[model samples]
Target chain A: MKIWALQDQVLNPIEQKSIDSFKAAGGNGSLETFGNDPYKQKLRVAIGSPNAPDVFFNWGGGNLKEYVDAGKIADLTPVLDQNPELKNAFIPSVMDGAKIDGKQYGIPMRGMQPVLLFFNKKVFAEAGVQPPKTWDDLLSLVDTFKNKGVQPISLAGSQAWTELMWAEYLLDRIGGPEVFKAIRDNGAAGWKHPAVLESLTKLRELIDRGGFGDNFASVGYDMGGASTIMAQGKAAMHLMGSWEFVNQQDQSPDFVKNGDLGWTAFPAIPGGKGDPSNVVGNASNYYSVTSDSKQLDAAKKFVSTTLHEDSYVQALIDAGDVPAVVGVEDKLAKAPNADYTTWIYNTVKEAKHFQLSWDQDLPADDATFMLTQLQELFLKKVSPEQFVNAVAAR
Target chain B: MQSQRPSSWYAVPAFAFFGLFAALPMVLVVYLSFTSWQGLGTPTFNGVANWSRLISDGEAHASMGRTLLLMVVSWAVQTPIALLIGVWAAGKQRSRAVLSSIFFLPLLLSTAAIALLWQALLDSNFGIFAGGPQFLGDPDIAIYTVVFVISWQYIPFHTLLYQGAARGIPASLYEAAIIDGAGRFGRFFNITLPQLRYTIVTSSILMLVGSLTTFDTVLILTQGGPGTASRIIPLHMYITGFSGFEMGYASAIAVLLVVLGTALSVIVTRATGFRAMSSQQEGS
Candidate 1:
């Protein structure tokens, strides 16, 4: 049995060792691993071919929905039903995306990735500001940081999806979590919604205020370009997902250890329909059994074996991740930074609705199309109406 | 005529290779272009929707303009410089090998390696030389950077091609021109320029095709950011097919690229009056 996984495990070498140990000690039959390096599309092509791996990893929503629709993925509802313990092993909301037509198709195999508004505590202290608690606070901080000769935010503008996070959070804050949900259901009608328009309008304001600074249009996230700015204090804050922490730790260890890399939930919008506690990002990474895989039994056993394994969860925490496993709070307390870990755990736990990132929520083509429109919006080449019209036009 | 005809057996291996590799895949692409599929089972036949979308796709249409712009810039900048180097290096007897190797080193490194090297060197804050243009970030300058890098990598190749033609130019013609009191400028125009006409046209055609389909470097460096400023056709196709999972649409883009490349090549060769220079040679 060959398992295809994201490259993060490769970065944390011991995690692979844990997986290899699981494959050996569990006696889940013979197993092999082939993962990392191949681009997402290349991986999709491989899974679509006859030589598809028995089990593969994915983000579970936009990437997996088409696979499930095409019947190329196995329904994991049966596995979950047969083993209640396995079903209860992960947070229920984290598995919501793994369902297609109300049947589970994927198993939560990695940590949660909720988007966080990370700030530089030293910069904020010097500028006499704190992490924003309300939308107005965040808006005011933009000007305050600029006056203090700091870029308010570091945006990975070269990657459009990083830009899309703003819209996701903005829409969620203004219209609540259902703005994207409605849009995902029906495109044109959803695009015309007042909340959607308001979100785009807000994004433009952020750009106009130099919230991300003038140079943001060229910075990229793939090589930690934006992360560097945030860590080096060139930028006072960065709006990014949980992965930003790990990335910063890798890029600037000094920043991580002493630079006060603080995080808080996205700020609240006044007069908004959205609950302040609503969250958005990648809910979780998952492993799905392919329809054409020859080693179905072994693959299912592999999933079940790794689900509650203390070693697997511990490894994820050690890698600076907040695992989606059900009882991770106590385990997270023992993590490197217990306060940050607890806050993240509580943020996800208390969330009324956790919307996935817009790019990962919409189907693939629409996702790509939407990202382009958002990018154009940031560049100010497209008006708010035009952005909506382009998205609705699709 | 039948008795003089060569046996068809000689073409079997060639034809087999073509059918199994080139012809088969091209046919599949053509078929795939007309249908809606996610690289998985049961492609629902969606007639012309993909093509129709490409026609109205605003970002895509804009990206097409950028791709052609890149092609034009590459042809203008690369060909003349390559010819100059080829002519210069051709005249060098002692250091020809070393000069050629040094010039071709950029082409030898992988695209990923080159992209990384340039990215580090051109980093605005932390690059090797420090503080210059954001080569991979600014949409306005990013495409030009790509053109620069592309020229850097491939100029040696074009130079090598021109060197072959330059070496073939009869020294007798230059000697005759010298006897006629032609200085360096006069001899270059009368002899070197006319002699390299065929090579320039051929290399231009190659360079144009290469520019149209370029992906790896831009993908690594920019991923067509700061809006669609650097988003060329091939990168768009990859994003459409792979990220969007619209394989059929991607194939449509690919098919259009082939048609466009072939059509332009024909038009260019004809416009250049390059209907086989051999015929002109015979006439002279």
Candidate 2:
């Protein structure tokens, strides 16, 4: 059997060990890995060819749904039904990411990544302000940071997906996840939801107020862009995924070590319809079996047996990942970077709705178009009404 | 003697390779343009839906405009610099040789390396130009920045081309012009410029087509960002096909590119009389 997975230094070694254990357990396979963009393109091409991997790693939601709809993915509902213990081992909300049309096509295989508003604790202290807990406070803090000649927020606007976190959290907070669900399930017409315009108008106001500063459009998430800006105290706050803690730990160890990194849930808007407990990000990555695999039983066995194993889950926590497996609170607390990891674990545990990233939740074509329009929206090239009209018309 | 000439069978391998790699893919792309494919399962024919969509795609139209701007601006910027340096470097001076080698450094680096290098150099906060103008961020300036980086990468190559061509110009021509009391500028115009005409044509065509398909630089540098300001046709096509998984629409865009590229080169060759391939040296 052939398996494909994402390439990451910390994740790959752990996965390699899992693959080794699977091999030792009489499951035969080799793992190939690729960087993010290349992996998506390769998987898309591979799924259409005769050489599709028996087991493959994929983002859940609309990304995987396309494969499922084409009859390319095996329905894992029966496998989960046969082994309820295995099914219940993972967190349900994260697991629901891979559940399509009432059928489980993938199993949760990695950490939960929820978008959080991270701040430079030292910067906040020096500026005599706290991390915002409400929408009004966030706006005031934006001014406070700007007055100190610090960029209020560090946003990696070059990559649209980075900008997407804001939209996801905003829409979820303003009108709940139903607005996006309508867009995802129904089509472009759902983009016309009044809530979308309202959320975007709020986002546009933030942009116009210089929340992200003048040069944000060029700042990237990787290669010392926004992360570095916040780490170095040139920026006061950064809204990013939980993996950002690991990235900061890797890129600027002293900043994380000095206890200067801080995080909180996105602020609540007054009179919002949604619960404050709602969250958004990549829920988790998953492993799915291809329907046409030659060694179907072996592949399914490998996924079901290895992912939720104590050793695998422990290894993930050790690497600073908050695995989506349930009952890992104690393990996360005892692991390295315990403070940050436990916070993430609890935040995810309490979230009323865990939204997969909008890009991952929408079909690829619409997601691609939406990201382009999103960048334009952030650049102030399009107004909220214009953004809504353009997307809805699609 | 006539029997020693190679038979037509010698052309078979070359023809076979071209047919298999180039012609076959072109035919497939054209076919795929007529279907709806999401890069999974079989492509289903959807008639002229994709073509009609392409005709009305405002983004694609903007991308075409950017592509043209990139081509024209890069050509305008690279040609004079490469030509001047190539002619200057053609001299057999020891100092010139060292300087020319330094000028050729960017040519040795991979496209990915060059792009990344410039991306870091122009980064808004941490880069060398931090706090200066937002070279890679500002929408109005991003495309020009792309043009500049591309020229920086390819100018060395075109310089090398012109250097070889310049050296091939007979020394007798310059010597005769000098004997007529021609100045440096006069000698360059009367002897060097006309002699390097064919080289300029070749370099211009390469520059034009190369900029037409320039993808990796913009992809790495700006990613058509600061809000689609730097997105050109090829990048737009890539995002549509690979990122969007709308393979059929991307194929339509790809087919348009093929037609445009072919027409461009043909027009250049025909307009400039480059296909004549006649010798420039007198009494050769």
The local distance difference test score of each candidate is 0.82, 0.93
lDDT of 2 at A28: 89
- lDDT by residue (tens digit), candidate 1, B1-284: 55677788989999999999988988888888999987767678999998998899876798899998999999899999999988887886788788878987886898888877776677655665344666665668889988988888889899988888888888888898999999999988989989889888989999998898888988876777668878999999988987788899999998898889889889889989888656323226
Please, what are the lDDT tens digits per residue for candidate 1 over residues A178-292? Answer: 7777787666568888898988888889899899887677777756588888887889888898878877777888988995798888898889999889888899888889888
Top-scoring candidate (TM-score) = 2
Q: Count steric clashes of candidate 1.
A: 0
Tens digit per residue, CA lDDT, model 2, A1-394: 9989999888989998999998998778899999999999999999957899999999999999999999999999999999999999998999999999999999988899999999999999999898999998999999999999999999999999999999988999999889989998888999899999999999999999999999999999986989999999999999999999989988999999999999999999988888899899999999999999989999999998999999999999998889999999889878888888899999998888999998998889999999999999999888899999999998
Q: Which sections of candidate 2 miss by over 4 Å? A: B1-3
Candidate 1 stretches greater than 4 Å from native: A10-39, A292-298, B1-11, B93-101, B128-133, B273-275, B279-284
User: Whose lDDT is greatest here?
Assistant: 2
Candidate 2: lDDT of A392? Answer: 96
lDDT of 2 at B249: 100
Candidate 1 clash pair list: none
